[model samples]
Structure formats: structure tokens, C-alpha cells
Target chain A: MIAIERNLVTPRWQRVALPIVSLVMASIIAGIVLAVSGHDPIGTYQQIYAASFTADGALTATFIYATPLLFTGLGVAIAFRMHVWNIGGEGQLYMGAVGASGVGLLCGGWPLPILIVMMALGGALAGLAWALIPGLLRAYLRTNEILVSLMLNYVAGLFMYYLIYDSTSFWRDLTSSSALVFPQGKNLLPSSDWPGILLGSFTLPFGFVLGAVLAVLLLALFRFTRFGFEMRVMGDSPAAANYAGMRTRRTIVAVMALSGALAGLAGASQIGDFGHVLDPRGLEQAGYGYTGIVVAALAMYNPLAVVIVSILIGALTNAGFALQGPTFPIGLVGTMEGIILFSVLGGEFLGRYRIRFGRAPARAPGLDDEPGAEVAP
Target chain B: MNADLIVSIAVSAIAYGTPLVLAGLGELLAERSGVLNLGVEGMMLMGAVTAFFVSQTLGGPGLAVLVAAIIAAALAGAALALIHAFLSITVRVNQIVSGLALTIFAGTIGLSSYAGQVWGVGGQHGVHQLVKLDVLGLSDVPVVGPILLNQDAFVYFSWVLVALVTFYLFRTRFGLYLRAVGESPRSADAMGINVTRYRYVHTIIGGAFAGLGGAYFTLAIAPIWTDGLTAGDGWIAIALVIFAFWRPDLLVVGAYLFGALSSLGFTLQTHGVQLPSEFFSSLPYIMTVVVLAAASTTLARRRIGTPAALGVPYVREES
Candidate 1:
């Protein structure tokens, strides 16, 4: 049998350097494309980097953009480690926003701290409920969770559209023309806002810290907890998990719920920190939910890796906006993020196999004549 | 509550179902041949935007839809499927990831959005919409006729295409070969079938149909060149493929069913129904989940057929 040995050795530095190399390659290719189109590649890139980091208000925007991604990335990473494809992060996030908004509306006159906690709780539960559909299906009936979760994202979008656009409702504010002009939910009160932390020269939001803490806790749980081990086992092989007498169904459901909850937290956090109300159109390509997938992939499903990668993506996204001047539209700048992700994924090939030039031999029918075939000595 | 309400609802459903059927039939072909494409949504969006732009430029809805269907929509969709085929078939990347990446790359907010902005202003209203195709004598018949025969040419074409696809899948040798490849690529490969070729060709062709569906949306339904026109219809098409049980014929039923559900929300809103419009708007997605759950039940899973290795990348192992 061709066994994948469970070696404890750390991945080599060359493996780590592959993505960087691929990024350089992708940039060079992108430069060629830009040159063909008569745009100055280096000038555009320089502006992008400057805008993402050094410029005033640039860093804050990046953090604001990264806020939702941090939560959703953790959400995706949590489920990914368990080999569960929870593509419903978008839906979960929307549900969380809906839930948080509900709490904010209902709990009038409550203490700020209690209201904030309740808002967060409501969001988490909503996300959990959104994810629960696929979780239950997979646990009980072995339905394809991927499609179900994905469809839910659209469902969530439509649900949000209705929540915001319905005129005669508590969610809608008839108080002004701006609200009338824009079909969206009522804005959050000032009290529900999340306070930011200033780090001398650079100021970062609490969402970043929340994201980091969650990543650390997740990493520790995976490294030290029995629950983590069971998840790892299940990811490797459901048969092995069954053999070990694990409560596979319950574990899958719980893991999915946890994943959904994290995504929900992201949605709720965004609503609390950035906007007062829900705008379905504004959230359509929030990009953070899908961006989280890239982060999780880059991290190789490692929680710590998720944090580092999330920051990188956040920086790139900020740069995309920064590069958006009159000459170069921001949309093309956004294309750079896509380039980075594609390059990283393409680079992943380096970790698994070596490419050889020789043609593969055609093995005859009666070759090993065994169920478990072996590599020739 | 009345007959008129029922007729209006039926009309809206048929209008909505037209695009769904086209996309679903295309998806059925791709899945039958062993590749599950997740880029259908992006392709449709490209088609819709392109058709809207072309119609405005050409000053004729017919010519614009034709160009969009063949060049912009089909070509765009096929281009994405090409990437998917290369990754899943040739280079052997993960099907789900490659497909998802393709969606994000050519996303609603991606290339099409930019294209829509560049096309600018003189939008879909400038183009002539396709005249409804009436089957003369059939038009006078009550409920069924209004919803079926008395409609746009695309609507009739969608059902006809579904029938044609159903026949091709079940009654042809190539169809048998396609099914074999999906069920067991290795076995099919051993039997001298070009596994990669079958997957690439069918996947691309499937994309063409999806693109056509998108063009239909821009030229027929919305009839306007708006950004994000297809919305999430492409993804809905993917879901419909599953709901239809990979059968081309059943796609007609599933498409109409979803189309009806989706339009029912908007129709209810127009009638001043007290129900929250969001509940109606989100019907398609909710129905998808419910249907999927129902289909996944032990009793249903066995009965509902799935293409074996539907999402697996075919890698030719070196001996």
C-alpha cells in the first residue's frame, strides 16, 4: 500500500517560501499583461502599497475591511479543519447581522453592556441556526452539505433585502429622505458601537484582537484537546473515526455550529462597528467571507496561520482601494488580490509532489494482483 | 385569491422559469459527464451584462442577445469551464476550489461590474425586447395556454431544449460513454474512452447553455442593462440540477417550480400583500434548502440519482 506516513517533521523553509516565489511570478505575469495594455505596472503597484499602509485613513479602512473577514476566516478555518465544507459563511454572517439588529431593536433601555452581550448572543445564535440546516442534513441524511450551505447564502441575501426594503416596519425608518432614498434597515444607535484600541502611531479595532484571541484559542484546542483530536481523526477518515467509537454525527453538527457562530460574530461585529443599518447591496460581495476561504487555505487550516493570512489579505485589499485614483480604477486594483490567491493556490503544488519528465509506465493487468498495491523496490 | 391572481402568478413563474430551464439542462449535461461546475453563476452574469450592452450598442434586442449568447455569454462561460477543465481534468486541482475561485474572479462584483460601468448609460430600454411567440390556436386556451403557449420564444425554446437534452442523455452512445465516465472514470479510461476530452467538451458546452440563460435574462426578462442583473440565478441553476436529480427532463419541472416560487414573492408585493416581502423574495433559497433536505432523507437519497465522483478530480496516477 502507498502509505502517507504520519511524520512529525515540520515543513521545510522552501515549502514556506513557495508562496512568496509564486507571488513574484504572478506579479511579473501581471506586469506583462499591464504592459501589453499600456499601463505602467510598477507605478500602479507602488501607489497600491503606499495607499494600503503609509497614507492617512488608509490603515483604518483596511482594518474596517478586515474586520468581517477576521471572524469569517476563523469560521471557515474551524470547519475546514474538520473537513466540513461550510460555504454558508455568508449566510451565517447575514443571520448574525439580522440577529444582532433584532436584539438592538428589542432590548430598549437595557444596560449598554448587557445589550451588547445580548446583541452578540443573538447574532451567534442566528448564525448557528443558519448553519444548522446543512449540519443536520449531513449528520442525518448524508446530503451534500456544500450545495445546501451555498444556497443559504443567497437565501440570506434575499432575507436581508426584505428586512431592509419593507417600508412599514420597525426595521425601516421613515424619519428621513436618506433612509427613503436607500432601501435598508434602520441604523444602530451610538451605544451599540465597538470601541477601538489606539496603538501609538496606528489605531486598530477590537475586532482584530477578538479575531487573534479566537485564533489562539482554536490553535490551542486543536493542539491539546481531545475534541480537536477527534475532529482531526474524522477529517482524515470517517471509517477510522467510527472504528474509534467517536460520536461522529454530534461532533460534525457541533463543529459546523461553531463555524457558523464565528461567521455570525463577524456580521454582528461589522454592523456594530461600521454601519447603523443593514444594506443587502452593500454586503453582496463583502468579499470577506470568500476572502476567509483563501486565508484558511493559506493557513493550511492552522488557526494561527489564519490570523497571519487574514492580515495579509486585509493589507492587500486596503492597497487595492489605495491604488484607486482617476487613472487606474479600483476594480482593476482589486484584481491583484485575485492574483495573489491564485498564485498561492498554484504554489501549493510544491508541498505535495515533485514533477518528473519521464513518461509514466503502463502497468499490465496482473501487476501486483493484490488489493493493496506497493511501490516497486 | 382570484383567477386573475392565479394567472398573474403563473405568468411570472413561466417568465422566471425560462432562464432556469436552459441553465439546468446545461448543468445536467456537465454533471452527467462527471464534472460539477460551480462557475455557472458568474458565466450567467457575464452573459446578462454583455447582452444588455450589446443590445444597446446594436439597437436591436435580437442581434444583441444573439451576440451575447454566442460571444459574450457562451464564450465567457466556456472560458471559465476551460479553466475548470484544465484544473480538474489536466492539472488535477480540487474541483470545488477551482470552481469557487473562478466564481470569485469573474464574480458579480468582478469583471462584469467593470464591464457594465464601461458600457455606460444607454442601457437595456434602448434595445427591442423579443416579441412573444404565440401558437395561434393554442393562445385562446385558458390557464395552461397563457402560462405555456402564449409566451416569449425563449420560453418555448427552454422546454424544447430540455426535451432534446433528455433524449441526448438517455438515447445516445455518447451519452452512455458520458455516464460511464461520471460513474467510474478509471474504468472508462481503461476502456479507451478519452476521459479528459469528454469532461472538457461537455463542461464547456454546459457553460454555453448557462451563458444563453444569462442572455435570456438580459434580453427577455429584465430587458435592462443593470449591474448584477443575474444576481444569484447561476447558483440557483446549480441547485436546480440537483433538485432535478440530474435528469434533463425533470429540469423543466424543477425550473418552473423554482421560477414560480421566486416570482411569487415579487407578485405578492405588487398585490399589496401584508406579508413581509423579504419572506417572498427569499423563497427560492429557502425552498432550495428544504428540497435538498427532503431529497437527502435516507429514502430520497437512494431514489435520487447522483453522478458518482461528481466532484472528484481525475488524476492519472503514474505507474
Candidate 2:
């Protein structure tokens, strides 16, 4: 019989080693899935790598996907860090786009810097409002935020369709005959487009820079702030927080709003940085909010790690779009992301416990046999 | 609406509600056994794709072909659930995350879409569809005749399955042990119940039920293939299980209620009840949110119906 023994302190080597093992394990699983579908796994991987990292315009394309992911990842990271499951990142992001696009359209003739700032705020506020529905309900009414937030994604998705496809909302472009024929959102003026930071050949999207800045602020917030201390303590042990008389409900609403704002940035970025028009199909298909969950999980909810992981996951998504075909289907991207998450969860489990092979020790060992054991001091 | 129109709407409501019943019943069993499998959507999609593929390729008599398709779909869903069972039960991954991962892995834009493409079934018309039945040949009778007597075989099967689950949960000795395991695994384990086995079996079976629900979508509803043909029925079904108070008898009622809501948009639009199609399309989801909030408030006060150990992994040594 095999028995799992708990690890008191995770050995330093295992932290680095387990991730590598998980990657290798995930690759094998992904390869098997690809092979079973009659696709060349090695070729697919190499193609994805080349398209995402090495092709001439590939890095730029990757940043296009990565921009929204960064915001959504940070949004999800904040809520998840505080043990608040805000899976409504997708909906929040859509609302964010609606929010930002509305602002850009309203004041497209404004000065460039001011227009960008207003749009960002508009997006963030929209996303925050959307997320607060679940957040407030969770805090006050004790509803399951998971179900509420997740369900709202569909509602938000439908709302976007309504604005563009069904209703003659302000967002819908009904002016020119061509615009009416296509049934699209009014395009933002050229001045509303946010400028990117250029580094020689590749340009860093303005949103990515904002997300990176937020990451530092987030890191500092946790490392230095009293609020962060309370948040972390509350996340780690709610009972302890209750004993300390912390306002649990307030934190839930605040963090939920904050997380939603972050996702809203993603939507704002989509309008300000790239689309300039609210393209529901484009925004919906990318699924940045959902992928952000994967990024946050892979980064272990660390803001700094979220930055690097977003790029990595972004590259994978970029590769998926590049390699879309009858054989290399779009579904493979989500499938691979799921496998990566599964292996990570499994790897974390493996890291925590030592599995002993062969017959069990016939005797129930006393607590003293272990060093610095889990028992209270 | 006229009597004829009302009767047709009720018939469509039953048709739409059948899948919800199947998926809700499956989730009820899993949640009852202390395992909340949120991968119902993913499982349902996998079941749908696989069932569609089999129905197209099997090349047999209609009855045999449908049976094969359904079995394949159940196995596909169960196969996916085994992953969640192992992750949540043995590996001790967070149940919520595990279920979400399962959905992501097999969702519309995931393995199901990949499989549909690989099997050459995407955008193809179904070769065979599940036929509607007229029970007792009562076709000419009014109102109840069409509503009760007319439905696809799967709709009737869903009712039977609900009754079976109700009996299994309330009337049997094993049923008592199952609830005990869900309520307090430590106590159940102390009393010599194999908690692990019970969770694994029920979760897998629950996945099979979700599979059958997905099969209903491709086999009857549209008889055409598309990514996410079930739309958000799987998610709505999850809410159905919750608002039903985890009771199988109540689940049927809730399923039909949502079914009516789901069909409302389509029915109304056909009868010149002008509204945004999206509003009609979104009713079930909006209703789910409203009902779930209501359920949460009521359940919070009473703290009844929900299993004590739901979403918690049972590790014997830790206990």
C-alpha cells in the first residue's frame, strides 16, 4: 500500500523541481491528446513556438492577446489572493469595454492624454459596478458569488450582442448606410487611441505597462500596507479575522470592486489599445477573463509572476490563433490550458506530501517520530 | 395566446426542460454525496459531441443507433468526471477549481470542439434524430393530451430516472448510508462506510446523467451540430439543483419551470410578442441568478438540505 506523508516545510529544491516535473508531465499529456487526434504533437509545439516567439510579427501579435490577459489576470489574482472567488472576470471585462468605449465615443475629440485617462476610468468603473452585484450580494446576503458571477457572464455576453446585433443602443452604429448594413459599434476617433511604449522592434502595449505598474503597487500593497496585512490574515484564517473583529463584509465588497476594476482595464485596453470599436465577437472569442484565471492560478496568485505567466499563456493563445485549421482546432488551446492547470494542482499536491511505496508500517507511529510536526506548539 | 399556441408552448417547454431535468438530477446526486461537480457543462458538451458522432457514423437501425449514441455520450461524460473524482477525492485539489478545470478542458472551445472537428461532425446535419412519442395514442385529446402524452422518449425517461433517484436517496438502506457519508464522512467512515467508493461511484454516475442531457440536445432539440449547442442549459441546470433544495421531486418541477422560461423567448417571438431576442434568450440565466439569491437567503437561515461535507475532500487520516 502507498501512503502519503505530509511535508512540514516544503524543501527549497522541490519548489523549483515540482514546477519542472509538472511541465514535463503536462507536455506528455498534451502530446498524447494531440497524437490521439492524429496531429503531429512535436510539429504542433514547434509551430506554436515559432509563431508566438520567433516569427517576424509574432511578438507583436502575442502582445495583442497578452494586453487584455494582463488586466484580467491581475483582476482575478487580487480576488483569488483574498480567497474571494470572482469568476466574473469575463463579464466585468465586457462591461469594461462597454464602459470605456462609451467614454471614448463621447469625448473622442478631447486631448489624447485626457481621453485615454477618462476611458480607463470609464472601463474600470463599469467593470467594478458589474462585479459589485455579486460582491455585495455575497457580503450582505451571503449568496454564492461563484454562481452569481459566473451566470452574469452569460448575461453580459447577451447584453453585448444586444448592443451590436439586436437593439439600436447608443453603442450601435446606425449612421452611414454601410455602418447600418454591418450593425457595428461606432468607431472611436483616432485621438482616443493610447500610444504604446516602443523598445526597438517590439512595442509594449500601454495596457501591459499599466498592468506591470499595478503589479508593483500590488506587491508593495501586500508587503507594506496594514490593509494588506488584514486582508492576508483574513484570507488565511477567517475565524482569526472574526476574533480580531475585522470588518469581513467591507473587505469582500472592496476587493470584489477592485478585482472588477482590474478586469475593466482589460476591456478599456481592448478599446483604447486595439479594437477602437466594441467588437463583441472579437472580445467574446478571446475569452481573456477566463484565461486570466488560468494565468493567476499558474502564477500562484503572485502579481509579479502573473506578468510573466500572462506573456507565456498569451504566446500559447497567439499560437492557437496562428495555427487555427481543420486539424489544429481552436479547442486545443483551452484543452491545453486545462491540462496545464490540472498538472499544476496535481504538482502542488505532490509537493506537499511524500508518497511511500510498498507495505504500510505495521504500527501507527507516534507524533514524536516526526520533526517540527503539524501539531500545535 | 390561443389554446393551440399554449399547448404547443407547453410541448416545447417539456422538450426544452428534459435536458435540464437530466443534468439537474445528475448534479443532485453528486452534491448529495458531498461532491459538487461544476463540470456539468463540460461533461454535457463532451457527451453531446460524442453522441452526435456515434449517431452519424454507426450506420444502424434508428433505435440501435440512438442507443449506441447515448451510451457513448454517457461514457464520455463519465470519463471526464473520473478526472474530477480523482482530483477532488484522492489528490485533494480544490473541488471548485477542479470542476472549473474540467469545464475548461472539455468546454465548447476546448476538447469537445476539437473532437467535433476531428470526428468530422462540425456543421453537419444529424443523420438520425430522437423521435417524439405519443403515449397511449391520445393525439386528438386537448391540452393535457399533447402536454402529457406527447414528448420524446428521453423526456419520459428523465421522469423515471428522477423517481429512481428519489427512491435511491430516501427509501434504501444504502441511500441512508450515502446521505450520512455526505453529511459527515468521519462519522460514516467510523461506521464502516467506504466514503471514497461512494463519492467516486456517485460522481461518475452523475457525469453519466449530464451526458444523457447533452445527448438530448443534439439528438432531439436541434438535430444539427454546432459549438455549444446546449448554450447555457448546463449552467442553468446547476442552479436548478440548488433551488430544488437537492430534492429529486422538486428538481422536476424546477426543471420544467426553467424550461418554460427558456422556451418563453422563442414562443413569444413566434406569436408577435415583440421584444429583444437577446432578452428572451437571457431569461433563464437571469432567472437563475434571482432564484439562486432567493435560495441562498432562505437556505442560510435554515441551513437545511445542503450536505455538511459538500465540496470538502475526505481524507481519513486527516479526519
Candidate 3:
């Protein structure tokens, strides 16, 4: 019989190797599933790689996809590092888009640099405001942020849906000729659109640069700042932090707001750089906010690693679009992601414990015999 | 409101709330066993897709097909739950992370969607559905007839389940063991109770219940397969558990109240009320947040009866 035992101290090598082993195991499981479903697993994976990396314009497209995920992942990582689960990234993103659109649509004639800065601020503020409610509730009222944030996602989606669905709403595209068509908001003003940076033959949106910069900034913050130290201590043990006279409540709110701001920036970038519009349908389909959770998890809540993980996830998502067919459907990518996450979570055990195939170790005479031990047959 | 409108609303509320009741009860059971399974949404989705696929492909009598779909959904949900059980129970991973991973894996765009696409069940209206049944010709009795006596088999089954679950939790020996496991696993282990077995059984059963609820969406509510058809209903069910103070009796009331809130938009529209549809659509989610906030107060949580060891993974130490 196989017996699993817990190790008091796991080696550093085992900790690093487990995640990689889990990823490989996840891929194999995905391959088996694909094969069982009558598709060539190797061909499917090759197609994913080829389309994501080798195909023309694929890298640029991947960057575009990665941009939003990068911001959201960073947001999630920051909050998670402080032991806060801000599941409201999607909601905050929508609010940020709303804020950015408000500025973009109303002040179209503004100068390029000023407009971009204002839009970024607007988006960040909106996200911060959205996150504030749960943050406050969590800090003061002792509410669970996870449930509150999650519930807010649905509320935010409906809020956006109402804005576009209602004809009289300012966000709606009233000038469109056909009222019978599916309701969609107007695009951002041409002046509000983000310019791309030239890289050889490809034009990468400025959002990518912004995301990368933010990642570096966050890494610096975590490493060198007093606030970051406070966050880390508070996250490790709130009671202990309080005992040490740290302002835990303030840190909680600050961490959550910062997280929300990043997510909001992602939302703003999505509209300003890629979609160039505030369409609810497009926003709903993007799901960068949810995908951010996976990115943060895969990166182990490290702000620096989120950049790399986001790009990989972005590539997978981009490849998913290209792989959609009778045999290799869009959902296959989701399945693979789900498998990978499960494997990683399961692998956490192996990193901490060891499995043995032998009889149970003999129990110490006095310790093994409890007062009520005779009750068992 | 007029008698006819009231009756109609009541009927619709029952239909809408049936799934919540099923899922909420399942979560209640799992939490009672000290296993906080956050994968209800994922389990529900898997169940929805599995049931839809089974009903679509198996050509047979409607009743048989419905039963088959329910079974298939339960199996699917159990499979997902098994992964969660393995991770949280055996692997000793953080329960929240495990549950979150499972949900992502089984959510609308994940395993459920993959299965739906592979089975070619997406976009197809259900061929077999759980039709409303009138008991003892009592459906003709106005007011109460359509509201009570004329619900589908799923609703009736859910009612019976509530009773059984309530009894099992408070009256039965296994129920006592399960509760003991949730309250204090260490003590339960000392008492010769298998804490792991209790948690696993309850969590898997909880998953099965969530799957049954998912099947209710396709088989009774819409009779069609759509991506994310449940639309966060599973989350609402989780909130309902907290609102009910983890009691089966209160769960029914909370579920029905949420059900009424969900169906309010359609009911008002049908009656020519000029309220914004979004208001009604967002009410359930908004209320879930409110209820969770209200229930999560330190005093309330203690008084309202959350499982003592809930969400904490138990690891037995060698003596």
C-alpha cells in the first residue's frame, strides 16, 4: 500500500521542480483528452505553438492580448500577496473602461499626451472607486472580499449592459441608423486612440510598454518600500501585524485600491489601445480579468513573473482563436488551462510531502493510545 | 397584486428557485462536513452540459431521458468534486485555491464548453425536459394549485430532499458523525470517526446536488443549452447558504426569496410595468452581496452557525 507522509522541511529543488512537473503532467492529460476526442494531440499543440509564435503578426496579437492580462495579473498579484482576494478585477476593469470612455468621448479634441494621461487617471480612479466598497467592507465590517467582489462582477456587467441597452443613455451610440441592431456604444474619439511603437515590421501598442514598466515598478515597490514590508507582514498574520502596531486596516484598503487601479488601467488600455470602443459585448468576451487570476496563480503571486506568465497565457488565448475547428475547438484551450491549474494545485502537495509504499510506521506506545482508543473495533 | 398575477408569479418563483434550493442544500451538507467547496458553479456547469448532452443523444421516453440526464449530471459533478476532494483532503492544498481551480476548470468556457462542443449539444434546444406534473388533479384548485401542486418533478424531489437532508443532519447517526467531523476533526478522529471519509462523501454529494441543480436549468427553466446559462446562480446559492444560517429550512425560504427576485423582471415586464429590466436582472447579485455582508459580521457569524472548522484542511499526525 502507498502511504503519504508530510515532510517537516521540503528541499528548495523539490519546490521548483514540482510546478514544472505538474505543468508537463497537465499537458499530457490534455493530450490524452484530445486524443480520446478524435483529434491529434501533437498536431493540435504544434498548431497552437506555430500560430502563436511562428505565424506572421501572431507575436503582435499575442502582445495585445497580454497587455490587459498583464495589468490585471499585476493587480491580482499585489492584492494576493497581502492575503487579500480581490475577485472584482473584471468589475473594476469595466468601471475603468466606463471612466476612460467618459473622458475619451466627451473630450475628443484634447491634446494626445494630456488625453492619454487623463484617460489613464480616469480609468484608475473608476477602478479604485469600484474596489473601495469591498475594501471598506472587508476592513471595517469584516465582510468576505471574495464573495463581495465576485457578486459585484455580475452587477458591473449588468450596469454596462444597461448603459448600452438604453437608447437615451449617454454611452449608447444614438447616431447609428439602425435602432433594431444589437445595441453597441460609440467608439472612442480618434484623438483618444493610443499610438503604436514601431518594432521592425510589427507595431506594438503602447499598452505593452506600460504594462512592462508597471511590472518593474511593482517589483521595486515590493523589494524596497516600507509600505510593501507592512503589506507583507500584515499578509503573513493580521493579528501579529496589529500586535506590532502596524496600521493593518489602512494597508488593506491601500493594497486593494492599488490592485483595483491596475485592473482599471487594463480596462482603459483595452478600449484606448485595442478595441477603441466601449462595447459591452466585446468587454464581456475579453475575460482578461478572470484570466488574470490564472496568470497570477501560475506566477505564484510574484509581480515580476506575472509579465512572463501573462505573455504565455496571452499566446495560448490567441492560439485558441486560431485553433477553433470541428476537432480542435476554442474550449480546448480553456480545458488545458483548467487542467494546468488543477495540476499545479495538486502538485503543491508533492512539494510539501513525500509518498512511500510500505506499512505505516509503528506508533509510540504511550502517544498512540488515547483515552477513547478502545472504542474502535 | 391581483390573485391571478400573484399565482403566476408564485409559480414562476418556484420554477426559478428550484435549482437554488438543490445547490444550496448541497453546499450546506458539504460545509457541515467542514469542507467548503467553492466549485458549485463549475460542478453545476458540468452537470448542465452533461445532462444536456445525455438528453440530446439518448433517444428514448422523455421520463427515462430526464432520469438519464440527471444521473449523467450527477456523475459529472461528482467527477469534478472528486478532484477537489483529492486536492483538499489527500493533497492538503488550500481549500479555497482548490475550489477556485475546479470552478475555472469546469466553468462555462472550460470543461463544460469543451464537452458541449465535442458532443455538438451547443445551441440545440433540449429534446427531453422535466415536464410539470399535477398531483391528484390538485392543479385545478386555483391559487395554490399552480403554485404548489403543479411544479415539475425536480421541484417535488427537491422538497423531499430538504426533509431528508434536514433529518439526516440532525437525527441520523452518520449525520452526527459528519457534523462532528466539521466541528472538530481532531476530536472526531480521536473518537474513531474517519474525518477524511466524511468530508469526501459530503463534498462529493454536495457536487452531485449542484449538478442536479444545473440539470434543472436545461431540463426545466429554459430547455435549451446556452453558454453560462446559470449566470452566477451557483454563487447566489452559496450566499443563500449563509443567509439561511446553514439550516435546510431557512435555505428553502432564502432560495425562494432569491427565486422571486430573479423572476421579478420578467413578471413585471409581462404586467406592463415600466421598470428597467437591468434593475431586476442585477437584483439577485446585488442582494447576494448584501446578504453576505450582513451575515459575515463577527457576531452574526458566531451566532448564525458557520461550521467551526470550515475551509480548514485536516492532516492527521503520527502519534
DockQ of structure 3: 0.52
Off by over 4 Å in 3: A1-18, A178-182, A354-377, B298-301
Scored by lDDT, the top model is 2
The candidate with the higher TM-score, 1 or 2, is 2
**DockQ for all models, in order?**
0.38, 0.59, 0.52
In candidate 1, which residue pairs get closer than 3 Å at backbone N, Cα or C atoms, i.e. clash? A187-A276, A188-A276
TM-score for each predicted model, relative to the true structure:
0.88, 0.96, 0.94
- Kindly report which residue stretches of model 1 are placed more than 4 angstroms away from their true locations once superposed: A1-10, A25-40, A101-119, A167-192, A276-281, A285-287, A319-339, A356-377, B1-6, B58-71, B121-128, B136-145, B269-272
Residue-wise C-alpha lDDT for candidate 1, range A1-377, written one tens digit per residue? 23332112336774567656766876886676556556788987777666776787777877877778788888988897777889899889988988888888777557877877887788889999999989988898877788889888878887777666754567767677787676657777777776678877666877688778988998888889999999988886778899999999999999999999998888777777677576667677565677777667656677877777777677766776555444454445334544555565566644444544456445587652332112100
Candidate 1 lDDT over residue span B78-177, tens digit each: 7767776776666555567667766665665555665665556324374556667778769768887787678877777777777777777789888888
lDDT of 2 by residue, A1-377 (tens): 88877776779787667656766787899999999889999998899899998998899889988889888999888898888889999999999999999999999799998998999999999999999999998998888898899889989999999999888888988997888568899899887889988877888899899989999898888789987887897777777888999999999999999999999999999999999999899988999999998888787777888898899899999998998997579999989988988998898787777889998656566653543222211
**Model 3 per-residue lDDT tens digits across residues B217-287:** 98889878877789998888887888888899999999998998999899989989987788889999998
Q: Considering the two chains of model 1, state its CAPRI-style docking category.
A: acceptable
Listed for each candidate, the true contacts retained, as a fraction, are 0.34, 0.70, 0.58
Ranking by DockQ: 2, 3, 1
- Candidate whose DockQ is highest: 2
Model 2 chain A, poorest ten-residue lDDT window?
A368-377
Superior candidate under lDDT, 2 versus 3: 2
C-alpha-based local distance difference test score of model 3: 0.85
The prediction achieving the highest TM-score against the true structure is 2
